[model samples]
Target chain A: MLHEPASQSGPDPASEFKTRLGVWMFLLYCLVYAGFVVINLVSPTTMELTVLWGMNLAVVYGMGLIIFAVILAIVYDFACRRRESALADTPAKGGKQ
Target chain B: MAITAFLIFVAFVLGLSFYLGQRTRTSSGYYAAGGQIHWVVNGVAFAGDYLSAASFLGICGMIAVAGYDGFLYSIGFLAGWIVALFVVAEPMRRLGKYTFTDAVDAKFDSRGIKLAAAISTLIVSIFYLIPQMVGAGVLVEPLLGIPHHWGVIMVGAIVITIVATAGMTSTTWVQFIKGSMLIVFSSILVAAICYRGFTTEPDQGGRVPVHEYATLAATEADSRLTVAEPGWEVVETHEDAAAKAAFAKLARDGRQTWWLISRTDDGVALKETEAVVVAANGTTLINGAPPSAENALRQVGNIEQLRGETDVKSGSISPIELLAGLSDKDTVVKRWKKASFTDADGGKATVYYPTLTRGNVLMRPGLKFKVQGTVLERLDFVSLMLALFLGTAALPHILIRYYTVPSPAAARKSTIVAIIAIGFFYVLTLFMGLGAMINAVINPADSNMAAPLLARSFNSLLFAIISAIAFSTVLGTVAGLIVAASGAVAHDFCDRYLRIPMDDRQKIRAGKLAAFSVGTLAIILGIAFKGMNVSFLVGLAFAVAASANLPAMMMLLFWKRTTAKGIAASIITGVVLSVGLICFSPMMYGQFGLDPTTAPIPFNNPGIVSIPLSFIVLVLVSLSTKNRNSGVAQPA
Candidate 1:
């Protein structure tokens, strides 16, 4: 008997691809979020400048972070579903299906 | 009317729980809602479970008082869901059974992993529970006109019934309903706020005079001024007492009195101020008079002047117009601050003074976070943001929601839904908070009532509905937390770790008992820690979860050299270090009725120090035990 992930009966073909995609996206988000924190620490006065649409950088940047998360999530979900179906249509290489 | 609405809401939630209770007899049904909840429903339920009282009441209240600093919480909180959606959701669903503990121990099958995870779950859940319980009591005071303790007990009883009856099934439905209603009603409230626009004379239709400062020329030490005022006399005077301001007690009708203080200036110019005195006998006097139908604490926050307009109102403006109006240089927003002192008769008195802040300053981040202050203050702000970003993926109640979905795909889809829904709701919080700040609806003594009070300013019916939704918000979050804690007790601690011989029915019974006990404990702590800020408490909870759970969970899933002993050691280290830092932190020292400045730890937040340390400990321990645990199965 071979050990398997607890929630699955057999191995998932797209598991490695999904993990790689997810980790890359996670790192990207971490960098953007860290930028928000660093700006507040290094020079918070920059946040007071009206950067866009007559709103301060603080308001613009904060709202932008929230809206950006939703966009990224939608894209991630779409890409993962495509990869999952693409892998499912191919025949098993070695492990029992 | 508000009471009626609150009662009806409670009845509907209770009835729904009992109806769902009939089908949840099996251990699986009780624990994970039979793992058949729809992706869409579970998605909204995730919103319901995540937007606790801290998000709704605490954020709104903080924004109403402190301006853009409060909006930072909204940003940090929504950022957390991104971590959940991209990193934790699919893997957590694929690796766990009932609780977060199940996932960490799935590869090892070690008792040490089970014990460490279970204790971590219980601690995080309880710490999270305190704020929801406290917010419930705060809502009850104005909504139902009851003491704070009674409200705590009432919410505790209702939530325990919800969790003990049908467990996850009823909890999920409650959260779904709450999530939908919260988003819909909040949208309606935001539309109303945009319609009202900004106004300079917010007290135009009021019966009482506006509580504005009155400046007068100081003549003699004890005698009346040359320009005497009727029904007012100076009874006592103290020179340069508070903040370099000379103080004088002005008596009215020989019984009631207000404060007349003058700041540092070449001339002696005294200004009349509002004061609330709490007598040793427990009676409260507002503005030198006992509160009654005629005399009460006046509603405070308002825009003193709108930009490019003199004494004119901007009626029915657009949402963008509202924000632009708040950021204009010429606009002036009135904010209040309180200073406390012992009066002549040994009674505690707090004087409320107004500062006319520039609109540009109000829309920026210096009011609460104090990022422009010392290095330690900046670190505290950054540490809090770090915790909020990392904490959501590690929360026990949130992690278990993945198990309620059928597959990793469902879990991933549901999390995306949660992010979109929760993100949109957070966007509305900014408008609602700013609306409350400019509408003169804020209660000077308690900022927590800002949102509900802003609704009341609209109409009685909207007020009643919003209050009811707020109460339901408390109910949903508390039920989710209780279920998570009970799962730790029944499944992780008893059945697996202790190797207790228990069937499905017996495990379900044990879970119910745990739910009851935890609920009772929540009630007692809620009443005990009254008057504390709810959002601050939630921040501490997030730090604990980030420290204790995240390091272990991420390592177990991704690191091949991870051992059971290493996971357990990291968890214990994270928990002890985070909890210890918080206990000795300046904020907790203030809560202990001591001088906060004398605390050993300079900062209040602990995430900057604890979270990284936890990861380091895990890596070192796992490397040392690599050879012994070589055969341990890695998670796929």
Candidate 2:
């Protein structure tokens, strides 16, 4: 089977790499997400607003997730592309394969 | 009147369903509509299905009532889409067959994987569907003046028929229509808020305070009313001097009088009975009677001002200003409280306290539990964080959507479109929520009425259109969810597990049947959980998806050491534990004590413990059997 060698491998990805990435990124997201959340815990800005539930804000709540998802997707796409192109030229890398 | 319009819409939806059902000839047509949806159209349909009545109505209502907190939910929800687009879209398309299970099973050929993934998809979709059904029930009742049960049933039959007929094609079109219309009408309502501008003045019919009251009887029971306001909060007035005098004599002689009003049946406004000041020692009387002035505490204050208000345009008020007057106790908010007293027979007599405002925390929890005061605290926050980080990537519907496209490029484009539409919609929700809060014409009784009511403030025609679109929005989403569940059943369980060597046509036909069954089930659940908040239900759905599916999917893709046994074990444990915990939690109970009948679990959500447990189970199982399946895997 056609596969790439290990020259381009990044730090020989550990079992915990994705898990750690998931954790840290999620932490940062929570911090940023708090801005909108704080408003709900406090108050709605409009003097004549429609309704409010605590920590539930309007500005790009779900869309914020979609955007982040898109960004990650782009990154994933690039990484996968690199790996696939590399694998196509070299043989199966010795380690995981 | 509303019924006629709703019925006509229902008929139109049904006719479309029948037309599409007849046209679904191929398995591709039934499952993924032969991978032919335009990115833009699919994106709009995504919006239609995702928005739902809770979003159109309840969220707006919540913001109008609760203020800033309501808008916060909107932000979280929109942000979650980012997780979906960038994380789950394109890669999922490249990997899976007809179902998310296809991706998992392709790697290991494990029956265990198929079973676990199928169950997880089914459970999450079912929980998510309940809220939609409930939303349908809420809307149908008001529009048709029919009870909530019929509303659920109606939505059910229509959705089942739609999915059973045209399959993904009809679902996509329905969603596309619903999504586009919801956004357009919502935009119109936002414009109206701008056109109307902010008015700090009281209503012409005597501005309804955020709270009001009428005495019912000698028993005290208070019912709180939700009011939308831009610059004022109403405090009920109980300044009837004549009635006070009349009741004063009877109250002193231990007699109680009754009054009448809407909603509360136990309200009794106690009058001029001499106030006895009991000292700290329980019964030592300091003053035998109330003060000479009319401004006694027991003598309900009539002249609570439209106080603490400024004339800033309601549209311009920042999130902070929306709830500014909420904390001002002198403004007198309305609520339900019980009055217990002794009777002539030496038995206790009770009355409903109507629109009585004594200071209580506006966002305070009714009872203290681990979860009661802690959603914003560390653990619950962690749970949500985990879900937000992973749920989008793992959602079955999202995974399958990727495969609908021919190439990864189409998936990428669709993801981009979804992001753009979703992002714009989130921005609009901010204005819409704030608009609902300030729209004096909005219904004060239901916070869920915020979006539609905001439209009504512009014009009833706008209101009718917005409401109709919102109903369709539910249909779009329900259709999508049913499609996902049916895929799991038809492709993963029957085709894979049962070893049924069916052709594409039979597979598609079976999927249609499965969609029909699941759709009906969702409708029944929707009716069962009526009146509960839709946002909360959505959160629960996210939690389960994140907890149950994310670990297994991620591990399989990212961890080279992952084993089929591990993936299977993790999915199994995650789904069961989360579902079990949710079912027994205090969120199911009305009280703090351990009540099995009331609680589904010990808390509201199980993400805190269950999520971690899933990861650990996966690791342990993988270690035991990691190398055994090395040669058995298929190429992606």
Candidate 3:
């Protein structure tokens, strides 16, 4: 309901901005994920390095990716909510002026 | 106790299905749960539907056997949800009606869209269904004492009932319940495994060394063996009747010839040992010894200490301590290494043996996806990861799930919740799978039994609970797939393309019949693909989905010039190419009794090629048809 007009006719400014925000964050996450894969492929032996509570590099990195996804989801939800509320608060007369 | 638990679990799911199915009268209700499900509930249901037998049994088994390489599946599958959440979740809810094809054919009234989308949906859904069914059959063998085919039939019958009765309404509730139970039960299993800790030997007793044979050379006529790895060799010629009978039994069982205790001299001698056999009339024999349950499925236990540890045979340790202790380079861990050799009959037989591996080596990547393997093998690994990463958003069953929620916002929130639930469960798989490995709870021959066997190690009660939950997991996923496949048949093909003169009531009826047919097909495929790792089959599913569906979806959403022809052509091309490559890949060649080198495809996964091919076809077709505006998103 917050972006109802965007759903009806065409893409709205707020929705477009949110899309951009999400895609950027997604790309950043992809880079981090790709780093994990590249490391495993090119220099797999490096994963044996002990890191964080004596867990191997691969374990820490794998778990870190999971935790990071959770964090991004929460952050994206709050930011979208804040943006929606901010847009809803803008006056109709001020918008045209 | 296991039967009771399994029956109670089945009864609960059936009751819920009938209750929800009764209210599902409308076509919308039957196909998409009337779009009335709560976002939170739908979110959990997504986890239930997404975490198929592959996620539970297959991933656990892979980790138990292959270590870190197995966990890669868990990571790739979870990460794919991010695509679902951010890219496809909201737009799919806004554009689609019942199936993912609805979203693709939203603007274009082209019959090509309907036909191509329907075929693609059927292919992808059936490919995905095979793994879930195979997993069902695998579970039945150990849990229910029934044959594999019978188990597949039961799952097929149960899932068809769920889909035909209530449709998405029943499917959603089943998934929600099963998903919650899967996570809770896995946590309990992991806790139990950690609390018990590791032991150097099996809990019951130590296995006595009956005979040790260092195989030097083995042929049909004669077998040469040594007492030790570098000891003097002794030739054993099969001239006597008793010795020949023992050699025949060993050959029949596909076991290697080894040293055995000599009957003439009361000492161990180099000879071919006889294999244990179960007669057709129920008699059992193992050389001169009585038949024992040791030949059957058995529990594997972990070691408590390393070669020279102070706290030898410690009773319990924290989960963190268990993994950390196992990571020590000096710790000797039992890892199974599989190899195929030419038997006496000149036939190749793949056999697995327990190899003493260093703990650090066992925990790394080279075990399954070999770093120094053939170039094609490395590419196959990367290609699989790519498919799993990109496939989640494009799957017909997963995409159709967005329509079950009420609004676009609801769909987005639901996807986030699903990511959380799925991500958490995947993390648990790491501990549960590693526990199975350290405890030696996995069968060297069949990796699919790892988790269930691991639970059996603690007690039969936990085993029953875990098996019942895994069965439900298969049920939930299969029901979702059948529902999606049926929608493609009845709605996309039957209604749109065939132009069947039918009311809403008739449409729902057609869907139920289609559901039955798809379920039957799934049962047959499940039986045929038996003995394969569920996760491996799922990887193939992901490849097809990513190749056939993802490109069309991405172009439709982001590109303004994508035409109806583009979407249809891309989907058809993607499906044909991926399936063709898989059929000719080395993996399939091995199954078909053909030389693997004769296969045209270099790697098993076709996503790396098919996905890009789909994208290029869509781009070229859309550009060629640029001037003939179809009135759907034509350059702003």
Report, for every candidate in turn, its global Cα lDDT versus the true structure: 0.85, 0.59, 0.78
Per-residue CA lDDT of candidate 1, range B1-636, in tens?
A: 999999999999999999999989788788899888999999999999999998888899889889998999999999999889888888888888899988888788877878999999999999999989999999997777899999999999999999999999999999999999999999999999988777776652353345556876656545444214566677665443434444567776656555545444564556656678898888999887788877777778888788857586677888778887788778888887666677777778777667678878888888988888998999999899999998989999999899887888999999999999999999999998998898888888888888998888888889999999999999999999999999998888988889789998998999999999999999999999898878878988899999999998888878878887789889888889998999999999978878788999999999999999999999998888877874364865
- Candidate 2 C-alpha lDDT tens digits along A1-97: 1111101123322212323443455455656665434443344232123244322123234335445544654564454445545555663562233
lDDT of 2 by residue, B264-339 (tens): 3433433222223333344422123323453222211121222334443234433433333333333333322233
Lowest lDDT 10-residue stretch of candidate 3 chain A: A1-10
Shift in Å, residue B358, candidate 3 = 2.0
Question: Judged by lDDT against the true structure, how good is candidate 2?
Answer: 0.59
Top candidate (DockQ): 1
Docking quality class, candidate 2: incorrect
Ranking under lDDT, best-scoring first?
1, 3, 2
Q: TM-score of model 2's chain A, to 2 decimals?
A: 0.42
Best-first order by TM-score: 1, 3, 2
DockQ scores of the candidates: 0.50, 0.11, 0.33
Q: Model 1's DockQ?
A: 0.50
B70 Cα displacement, candidate 3 (Å): 0.7
Instruction: Locate the minimum summed-lDDT window of 10 residues in model 3 chain B.
Output: B242-251
Question: Quality of candidate 3's docking, in CAPRI categories?
Answer: acceptable
Residue range B490-537, candidate 3, lDDT tens digits: 988998788888998998999999999999999999999887656757
